[model samples]
Every structure is written in structure tokens, then in C-alpha cells.
Target: MTIKLIAIGKTDDKELVKLIENYQKRLSHYIQFEFEIIPDLKKAKNLSESQQKQKEGDLILGKLNPSDVLILLDENGKQFDSVAFSQYLQKHMNSGIKQLVFVIGGPYGFSEDVYSRANGKLSLSKMTFSHQMIRLFAIEQLYRAFTILRNEPYHHR
Candidate 1:
């Protein structure tokens, strides 16, 4: 199965970009991983929170294939430990899905339509994080999960 991460906006911090890219490269050894960034909305200051979410949601939904399983990285979503997350990924792979898509929404979060389309929601932490940092965390967790599954030292290290 292919694992795809879709997030809004680009990462401007060079350090964060390098870290995220490092994990992305490591992920290639285990699975097909795709990181897609949707450009931030133009004139966002002029739009209401709901309007921005609606627009971002449209672009997010547009990136999916009919068979993709959508998972939102939501603040109120389920939380799992590293080992458990690896098991969760194993479960999906065993189920024979085509693509597993995880989305990190814009500042206003996901729209009603986006929520309705999601197969599940996962939270990395209870505290909030910046979008750019979350991208790195998510990618690193994915890498760590794969390592755990392989009985590698990285997980314990």
C-alpha cells in the first residue's frame, strides 16, 4: 500500500524541510510514500474562517482517488503509542488497501465536507503544533513505525 501525506502550505524553515526530507527518503526503503503540499490560499485575509476551510477542503478532496482511505490529523482524534501505531499500519496493509491518505489541514482545520469523507482521525499529541512542525513529526512517526515493525534499533534508540 502507498502512504500519502497531504498538507496545506509549504515549509519555509530550511531545518524543518531537511528533517522532513530525511524521513521521506528513509520511508522509500519500506513503502511508497508521497508528500504533497497544497499552496496556501490567496487573499486568505479577506475570507472568513469557514470560507477558507471550505476552499482548502475542496483542494484536499480533489487530490484523492476513489479508493483512497482518508485519515485526518485532528486535535481531537485517536492517539496511539509508537508500537500501537505500527500495528495500526500493519492492519491497514493486511486489509489490502490501495492508498492511505493522511491530511493536515489549514489554520482553520478541516471543513464539514472533509470530516464527512474521512475514514478515521489521528492525533499526534493533545497540545497544538505548527503545521510545518507537524509535517516533520508525522513523517518521522511513519518512519519510526516502519522501523518498529522491522525490529530495528531506531525505535528504541
Candidate 2:
């Protein structure tokens, strides 16, 4: 199965981009991984929070295929330790799905429609994180998960 990460906006920090790129390269060894960045909305200051989320949600939904399993990285979603997260990845891989899509929404978070269409939600931590930072975290975790699944030395107990 292909694992795709869709995040709003680009990473402006060169260091963070390098780190994300490193993990992306590492992740390519295990499974098909795609990282897509939805461009930041223009004139965002002119729109209300709800409108921004709605616009972002529309772009997110547009990237998805009908059979893709949508999972949102949300503050209120379920939390898992590293081992459990590896198991979660294994579970999805075993399920025979075409693509597993995880989304990191914009500053306002996901819209009602986005939430409604999601198969599940996941939280990396209870505390909030910047959207750009979360992109790095998510990609790193995905690479870590695959390494753990392969019994590699990358992850220590």
C-alpha cells in the first residue's frame, strides 16, 4: 500500500526541509510514500477561520481517491507509543488498501466536511505544534515506523 502525507503550506526553514527530505529518502526503502504540500491560501487574512478551513478542506478532499483511507493528525485524536504506532502501520499494510492518506491541516484545522470524511484521527502529542514542525515530525515517525517493522537498529527500545 502507498502511504501519502498531505500537509498545508510549504516548509520555509531549510534545515527542516532537509530533515524531512532525509526521512523521505529513508522511507522510500520500505514502502511507496508520497508527501504533497498544498499551497498556502492567498489573501488568507480576508477570510474567516471557517472559510479558510473550508477552502483548505476542499483542496484536501480533492487530493484523495475514493478508496484512500483518510486519517487526520488532530490534537484530539488517539495517541500511541512508538511500538503501537508500528503496529498501526502493520495493520494498515495488512488490510490490503491502495493508499493511506494522512493530512496535516492549516492553522484553523480541518473543516466539518474533512472531519466527516476521515476514517480516523491521530495525535502525535497532546500539546499543539506548528504546522511546519508537524510535517517533519510526521515524516520522521513514518520512517521510524517502517524501520521498526523491519527490525532495523534505527529505533531503540
| lDDT values for all models | 0.98, 0.96
Q: RMSD to native for every prediction?
A: 0.4, 0.8
* Regions of model 1 farther than 4 Å from truth: none
lDDT of 1 by residue, 1-157 (tens): 9999999999999999999999999999999999999999999999999999999999999999989999999999999999999999999999999999999999999999999999999999999999999999999999999999999999987
Quick one: best TM-score, which candidate? 1
Off by over 4 Å in 2: none
lDDT per residue as tens, model 2, 2-115: 999999999999999999999999899999999999999999999999999999999999999999999999999999998899999999999999999999999999999999
Q: What are the models' TM-scores?
A: 0.99, 0.98
Give the clashing residue pairs of candidate 2, or none. Answer: none
User: How many clashes in each candidate?
Assistant: 0, 0
Residue 19 lDDT in model 2? 94
